[model samples]
Target chain A: MRFDLEIKCKKIVGGRTKGKLLLSKKPINFLGMVNTQSGEITNTSNGFERQNLKGKILVFPNSIGSSVGAYTIYSLKSNNVAPNGIICTNNVDITTASGCAISNIPLAFIDNQRYNDLVNCIKILGKNKEIEITLDTEEGKIIID
Target chain B: MHLTRDEEKGLSGEYGEATSAAYRILVAIGEATDAEKLVPIKWAHVSGVNYNTIGDSGLEFLREISKDGKVRVNTSLNPMGFDRENLPELSPEFIEKQFEIARAYEKIGVIPTFSCIPYEILPIPQEGTQVSFAESSAAVLANSHLNIITNKESALSALASALTGKSPYSDLRIDENRSPMVEIVNETDLENELDYGLLGYFTGKTIQKSCTGICNISENTDMWSLKSLAAGIGTSGSCGMFQPKKPSKFIEKVNYGKREMNETRDELNTSEDGQLITFGSPQLGIEEISKIQTLMDGKKFTKPCKIFCPKSVFCKAKQYGIIDSLQKSGVDFISDACTCLTPLINKKNYDSIITNSVKASYYMKTSNKVSVALKSLKSIIKGYTV
Candidate 1:
């Protein structure tokens, strides 16, 4: 991959991986709104409702709802249907941080500005083609090719 | 964040995987929150006991950690799925999974005090004692009523605290953050626990600060009312703690009048009638049960009634024959399981529930996918008691 953009981010949980970007403008609720068995977004209005998040780097604003959402994330990992990594744009709550920690998933955060930049990059690259990005937790950046 | 030699060792895996994991979680959270160091805590009350809430994921996590995990501090547990003494007709798998969670916690050296109201049953440490409480209502009450210190911790963080006996010295643990940044003026009289719950819901939804100042509620507000207020705040939003007095300095001000209270009520109260009437989202204390015993006054319930209380409280009530009397009045006492997020009550079993607890109302609607008809304790007595 010929990497170009490198956006600074904060690492909540460690491990580097590359995967297609799956973006959501709204905060996610893992407990009820995400199906653990299939890694599908269950909320009717969440845009990517029926889409499977398996192996994708999920980009979202943040997590909401019960703290048990942490367990739902862990459940996803245990069930072998989970995101490759998670990138939160706004905030990294205890629920998100702990969930990712327990599940050994690379979780990172970016500022709203960087989030906008990533969104623009995705827009320009077009959504039809899968956008593979490298998430380096140790480097604390999201590298786009 | 600074870590002592022992803390560093724990983080470096000298102590074991569980301790290392706990330290990592605390340090990560501490660094994120900009805490200077980890603080020692006297107690840790952990949540995530209910199988319905955590599902398979939580059970697996618990099993994995329980292998090497042991509590470093006095740790307590939250409510589980059902009462062991009076088991409801739950699925075999749910019962088995719920027991596995209990066994895991027991193996990890949790006190098995399967009640949300730790402040109610457990002996109070000093007023300024630092604790890690995952139960949101208990955390709020610890800060507001008991003058103890704790952030409204998530289930995993509190579990990490249990294993490590330390928490991040950030958020409400810091003295500066304890002061309310928002002022919530109560414009209407809070006549009952439900009203206080509504006021709390209003304050929590409106204020985004770590703590808020609640004016006009008397310092003499009773314990039940305070618990309701705590549960309501814990349910609706992330505002963890509150003060009964006006804030010395505040950036925002909001009012909790009849309109605001009605708005909250309308949001939570989705059903005009309910099939089952329930009490105790924060498991009913002995005092609350006693009050209910008196209120029953030998009258039977018009509808099926279930009262979720702590086993300790249930035993005491049973000793007094209050349980016997209430049982005669067709009130079923369920210990070790609460009304909120319990598999015992769900959309499959019941279409709607009647509850006086704002916390219960919120979770029943959202988590259980059932409608809620929120009523005051007094109003329930008036309408349901025959």
Candidate 2:
């Protein structure tokens, strides 16, 4: 079944972006968890280990460690290996927000109340088919097939 | 977010690239947090100086802004990866990279304090003074102990404030957000710094994201104990300033038991046969230096033990003759950085480490990739007596 789900983005940066959805239930620490040079996820415990976030839509709950994680995200952009778009399901801290703003990466976030539902939906949405995100519009939505 | 015409111009790139970049960052962060307007900040203490952690991308960003723009307000930098002068055994390549990072910050008009405890040299902001601080312990300390207003800003946010002399009006800076959301009942009497630290760790783990009110503290509580709590909570969980009052009108109330504190203490303790004993996680002050010197007097140690403190206090130690005698006892000093934040972690691999800080124990597991045996300073210092 194909579905069109609308994500009520509380905050948006860089208008619109689209890419295949890559989701992680665990929070990320950009400093060590991400390889800025290649845009690959490094932290093994998160299950996305060695997976490249480049040209993908990176989704997660919130930031787990250091404020320096923001620069890691910025480095991803500067090196031309950044995620096409980002969606954090909790408070968009200055670290993640600044990373998106400085790098011109599109970012959208869901509030805590609806964050869990979105996580479950993404897990199910990524089961068999591909998913894409388009954040250019004021409304943040994902097209699922 | 509302912006004045001047701020609008800064956003429009009329104020040059540096100001425009910094302005755009602040406005974005402010908008994310639902901030209404911008406010001037008196101080900015930024972290993420460890080049080994942030790598080349961070260097690129720092140099890009610092080459043309200077900091607008007083600023302090956090620790770097290596001690370029004292730690001569480090690779020259690593030393050059560390120097590059330092120069980038210096060019931006940041004081090369390189200490996590920025309050050591920078004057503590008076109560209710708006400030932009990034280091977790420093943020909590400025808010709870020193009565200064701050939100836990990111490295970039703090850097932006350093360049622009302002931050978006946000959570902790607002007066209404200062009220406690949780009242923590603490009947247990904390005897030592470790106890205070464990309690703080417990508070952070228990009340994950609330402004907690802690009560039943002794009147004799000093800044050292407060620092232990602040550092513990900062590292363990994302907690903001804690009010020192008893149970009050708050949404949630949590009771801290001695059993839970003991469990945490046990969890933190590793092998007693530690390869190295490290002190000064947050960088020791003059009083701590004097205390350690007093304990190490006329004694010899066997383990490769070192105490970390900033250069400011290192000078104080030398002036007090604390370093000379301690050096004779086989103790080395790491000046200009804290042990946890420095790149020494990756270089110095160990089977086990002994430290007096719960915060140190937490960070060591991540930063150094090793476990730590949590000990009281008195116990660790006394164990070295020959």
Candidate 3:
């Protein structure tokens, strides 16, 4: 997944990349599942149970569940167990978006045709230690370099 | 964006630091929704339950700030299941801590009437009534069905809006935001609360990211059915907005729909397989529990059944020996938190669960990989268990 990337957010500030990218084809609900304080996927039924985001790009279709899901994301960030960047098939839910804005997590939504191709490439790249994500708001594309 | 002068003044700290904190939170929330101004509100409904995800820290912070002065507002709250009745005979120290938290809110004029369906106690806002509500499920119902205006405010922002009686004019406050994006047409006969629960699940699963309005409902819908639908939708999707066009006809619709759906599925309906019948995903209120006791007085469970309710109501039931009699009849009564959200139980233990709550059925579908049947409490006791 060596390509250019663009990002769109309320605001964007550069931060260090800490880990690999964990992708989920489905949306993730955090209310009863994720432990906000510990940043552990305490939810046994969650698709990403026991998976650590520490420094990974958490890719998901979108966020599901309560408005508190946003707060949980912030808790994860405060606990130093947040995704480095988020790549979503669509816009994150308002609650999760608010959490990302508050926590300053880099997020990019892919709405372009290239998204399908990019997703396939990213999956093949698997979880990497050092991958860069860029978002092009005008093009509605997220590039992984 | 569309802020009233009063809201602007509060945000600018004309009221006080506590109000200022609330204002900041509201402003952030308003900005998130791309709202330009604020709207005046009459009532404020707050979320009081401690779901570990929201944490106790936010509540603690609000309490600490409110200790300095009164909040100058009228407010209600979503119930927290914990209460003296539920956890009776606790240490004085524990009681003191709980009182301290309550006192903080009391100082700010928060009436701690622990309930989510405040409309049951307080008057529901009339159509186009602008109010500030926090709880997502309630907010959606109030805004969509009642045609009341309330932004899906964040926890602190809801408190701030309540204090000032104003919120940033946004999607919910504006008339245009009330438009239904997704119209859910019930093609099948939705005869009961369980059917509505299933309908809500199916709708949420299908139409993600859209506010749904259930239209053309069969005449059999009831309050319990609608509430179940709301609960299921709330759990299955991010939809906090739902308006049943003819809410007044809900009960009639549920009755009709239940009979039709059940009648159609009769061949598929099985006998009482001795599975557990659980209630109160949102925690049964006192009235609901009393109704259950009355219904179960002469009945014995053919199979094992468990009723989970808020600890507060559970205590009253215990004092009245309703708990004992129910337990003696093989119906285990447990209280604390909602069992629907409780991860302590194994899903594989039960062949199926029968519940009256639409919210429980919705969550169970996702949480438990089993056949969860919905039936009225009356039906359950009568052995017409699905």
Determine the backbone clash count of candidate 3.
Answer: 34
Models 1 onward score TM values of 0.91, 0.91, 0.73
User: Model 3, A1-145: lDDT tens per residue?
Assistant: 3455444333222233434657666677765456566566655544565876667777677766555566666667767877777666654455555556556676555554555666656556564545556543324445567
Tens digits of per-residue lDDT for model 2, B1-386: 89999989988888778889988889889877889999999999988788776777778777788767789899998888656567656677778777888998898899999888888767786778888888877887788888888887778888888888889997778888888777778868788788888888788666645367888777568767888888777665556678788567545778778888878787667556577888877778888778877777768777777888888888888987889888888888887767674566542567678888887776666556676878887888777557
DockQ of 2: 0.53
Residue pairs with backbone overlap in model 2 = A16-A135, A16-A136
For each of the candidates, the C-alpha root-mean-square deviation to the true structure, in angstroms, is: 2.9, 2.8, 6.6
lDDT per residue, candidate 1, B165-199, as tens digits? 99989889988999887789888989999999999
How far residue B125's Cα lies from its native spot in candidate 2, in Å, is 2.9
Candidate with the greatest lDDT versus the true structure:
1
Q: Which 10 successive residues of model 2 chain A have the least lDDT summed? A: A136-145
Candidates arranged by DockQ, highest first? 2, 1, 3
The per-prediction i-RMS, to one decimal, reads: 2.2, 2.1, 4.0
- TM-score for candidate 2, please give it: 0.91
Candidate 2 chain B least-lDDT 10 residues: B339-348
